[model samples]
Target: MTATARPAEKPAMPHFSSGPCAKRPGWSVEALKGAAVGRSHRAKVGKTKLAQAIDLTRDVLQVPADWRIGIVPASDTGAVEMAMWSLLGERPLDLLAWESFGSGWVTDALKQLKLKDAREIKAGYGKLPDLSAVNFDHDVVFTWNGTTSGVRVPNGDFIPADREGLTICDATSAAFAQRLPFDKLDVVTFSWQKVLGGEAAHGMLILSPRAVERLETYKPAWPLPKIFRLTSGGKLIEGIFKGETINTPSMLAVEDYIDALQWAKSVGGLDGLVARADANTKAIADFVAKVDFLDFLAEVPETRSNTSVCLTFKDPAVASLDDAGQQAFVKAFTGFLEKEGVAYDIAGYRDAPPGLRIWCGATVETADVEALMPWLAFAFEKTKTEMAQAA
Candidate 1:
């Protein structure tokens, strides 16, 4: 094969993509120096940092006194899976899925575990599953926020307090941006690469006392992996809830998470973070209101997400185009924005419908989101022009 030439230089502009979202202000070189590198995670310094992280999370989130937080293996996915494999065998499961992530959990329950009696409630991308019809007697699994569809559960009011089952929630994008009622939640999971804007590879799992009891009492019929085994021989491993992680962790990533947490504290804690996310979402809402063709993918304002905002065009701008044409147009539009350095990685998920998905998390400023709107308009206009010319 012929050798490929390297690029002479890199592009310069702000990047605003979801998932590995934009970093906090001044998070480049200066931030790296403060990170604890070349150190064992089991060292005293590493343990101290990990403990500080847990404390800060508790402080910012205002978690209950009895609840416990720990760093879990992998990212948010691992945390959720660990909970599923460890504590979900005793009761019938109600898996609610309205979007991609929740659907993934359903797949795990049906295909992976082959659970014959798992009740699956589903809806379209922008809508929520019917919670009123859910059985409170069974264990529940759900994603608090649908990142791909930009929809979220309005609150925990739908959950019944007297229910016998546990509620396991995947709150990766909703952790810092929205309110989560710990009292109603049994197992909550989130990742560092979400609303807090930290590096990936680590997940935080918060367990209520009920979840712990489930882990200690009931064992799954399936074989358990070493990392997912929170209980051994009918005993809760209390040390895991402390600074003791199951496997060796990247100290550098841990330090990065600390930096993000410190940044979260400096900005006035969880309330401030929520306000920032709200402001960004309002900016997009206002823009969407004025635009003729653009509409939010979320069905209702109350259920809309403040972090990931998905949009779809309503006009006949590219309706007549074939699937290939639509794909080409989307590629060109995203490519234009990327090359212009106005935005990065704003493309909708491949499995979802054709649209644009923007990250409006806490770390992203409202001013930056506002600044990018006109560029989106510019890209849309260019794409339309190209499509009309092709016609």
Candidate 2:
């Protein structure tokens, strides 16, 4: 008698981690294998491909003609640091903090650079610090989207056009998924591992004309590292933005980024990408509306993010559980989904209140997310059962 074979396990549900988020459906290993590897990034072929990537990005994003784009060392963090270290001392500064990444910038300003006069406006996770109180007369720094908290500045209309201060925006998770008004921005930085869904380890720095002027005329008192140097002897190194990277890059990663950009262009550019992200957010929104135990972390609809959507349990029934018990329930629920191959990495950030943080970026499909909702209900039921047994 032949033994019966075991049933095949279902493939894992689409991953929703905020950083290094899901890739486009149908992305393949064969395409990645074709990427240039073990090749000198300074070679003519490498430079040519890099230039093409920049040009394609400009066209797709509809970047202004005068703006410059550079491939800088480090991910988004490195790119932001380069701008802060190089251009901040020219004027008084206003730093805004609502979440972890924003808080990191404030720390750099206070402790690392030791800028005494900088004004800091901060709020806890899941909320935005008041933007109305900001004095635009001082150099302004903020994240276009708070990846950790799922709050984002809705638009650039809040920025005064005639304001004398330059605006620096950290837009790593927002670049491909949201509408960014370049006219109101001075320095913008992002990385490939975000909405674009490519390799990490490199950052893109986009500079407006006003930012270039600052580099040429105003010099910071701080020492410039080779990676952050944008000028030499009061003259701008214009070629760096045209694909002459400051140091060696991973050519394979460059090619992977190019593949993602090409995919972006093929999918109808920025508008199409934004629509995909919006649909994913809507999926989560609909689910939250019907679930009595869940609610969005973002207090206002206008401020809700289309990319990272965070959720928290709101049922008073669960409130009876102590903090440790609540955490244990969350862990057990997420753990059940992982074992069932329904989702991965849905845990909240350590610094934030206990909840789930899901990436609804462009690369994630709404259908996959829809399929996982029932599984979430199943997991939650399992948690309640486990908790009662423990009690």
RMSD of each: 5.6, 4.4
C-alpha lDDT of all candidate models, in order:
0.85, 0.85
Candidate 1 positional error at 117, Å: 1.7
Residues 113-181 of candidate 1 have per-residue lDDT tens digits of 888778899999999989898897999999999988999999999999998999999999999999899
In the predicted model 2, the residue pairs found to clash are none
Q: Clash number for every model? A: 0, 0
Candidate 1 TM-score to native: 0.95
TM-score of 2: 0.95
- Clash count, candidate 1: 0
Stretches > 4 Å off in candidate 2: 1-13, 320-322
Clashing residue pairs, backbone N/CA/C < 3 A, model 1:
none
Could you give candidate 2's per-residue lDDT for residues 128-183 as a string of tens digits? 88889888889999999998888899999888888888999999999999999999
